[model samples]
Target: MGESGAGPGTVRPGGRTARVRAAVLQAAGDLLAERGFDGLDLAEVARRAEVGRTTVYRRWGNPSALAADLLSDMADQSLPRTETGSLDGDLLANARLVQRTLADPRQGRLFCALIAAAECDERTAGALHRFYRTRIAEWAPCVEQAEERGEVPPGTDHAEVVRAVSAPLYYRFLVSGDPVDVPAADRAARAAAAAARAGAFTR
Candidate 1:
């Protein structure tokens, strides 16, 4: 929540231990963006965070695990699902959030780096998948709300629907290398919205 260059002093106390953990997690994210999965050094991370290296190793065990935790933390901090009184609007909002996240100067490259690293690392891949699941779960209710409003079929897969809105953006990032611009986001949202209406995402 603090600026990128903010000191470790911004850490607050829900409890002393919790504050230290939070500082370590935030620092991990910054470091991951600055360096990368392969570039990550646990000792260096601990030193920069002003936390103990032993504690870091004991807690997360390794760089990949630390990346997972950092990503999971980011999902928790993501904006709540937008309910704009219309299914199309809600889906578009979700798409736009994805677009914005992938377009961030540092976070964008950070994600690309993580995804590439996960390709050969099963543990990292599973952890990254779980992170996506968390984000999808957070937004699933919007789809459910749509079903209740008769905007989507009753059997529509809410999680899948939310995931659909993001699939194209990731495809572009990972495969297509196409622009994740506003127009692309809008198209992804509209496509997902239409598909859901027609039961494409329904089980």
Candidate 2:
């Protein structure tokens, strides 16, 4: 299998290789969601994926590497940002998207597992950071557009603005354990928009 030029854990192969990768990642995600990182066993994952243990061990080597690959796959599959023609509208869209994902049963548990795994594993932590960076870059253009429209200061940090919109939602998801509903999402979006307009994210 030829490795993708993008980065680690981003191999893009065809035919049997691709099928094996897909099955492995799917099994890994299920296991992570079910038992977090501690319960992620390469042999069990191989069984769940219905693939050879040798194949799983040779391809990923360890649970952390498998987690990294799963995160890479997630980054590759994440949805594109919504363009709504206004800063508030765009930010609202972003906030709602985050809220929905973090509020979903399976997805929410999966993310919690990933975050917990990242806390203890350096490789998983790096992969998690890279995943968020990729997501932030994907949505940062909305803030840049707002700046171009004179909605915010010229030096406003676009990525920071985008992060602000998600910070509160994530806080609820990972810390406060509050429900991430529509109201919370809307509040986060408005707060971020207000902060941006107030030059709070200025570089």
TM-score winner: 2
lDDT string for model 2 (10-112, tens) is 3367888988998888888888888989999999999998999999999999999999999988888787888999999999999988888888776778888
- The numbered model that scores best in lDDT is 2
lDDT of 1 by residue, 120-189 (tens): 7777788778777777877888989999999998899998888788889989877988998889989999
What TM-score, to 2 decimals, does candidate 2 have?
0.93
lDDT of each: 0.78, 0.86
Residue 76 CA displacement from its true place in model 2, Å? 0.6
> Clashing residue pairs in candidate 1, if any?
none
Q: Which stretches of model 2 miss by more than 4 angstroms?
A: 1-13
TM-score of each: 0.87, 0.93
TM-score of 1: 0.87
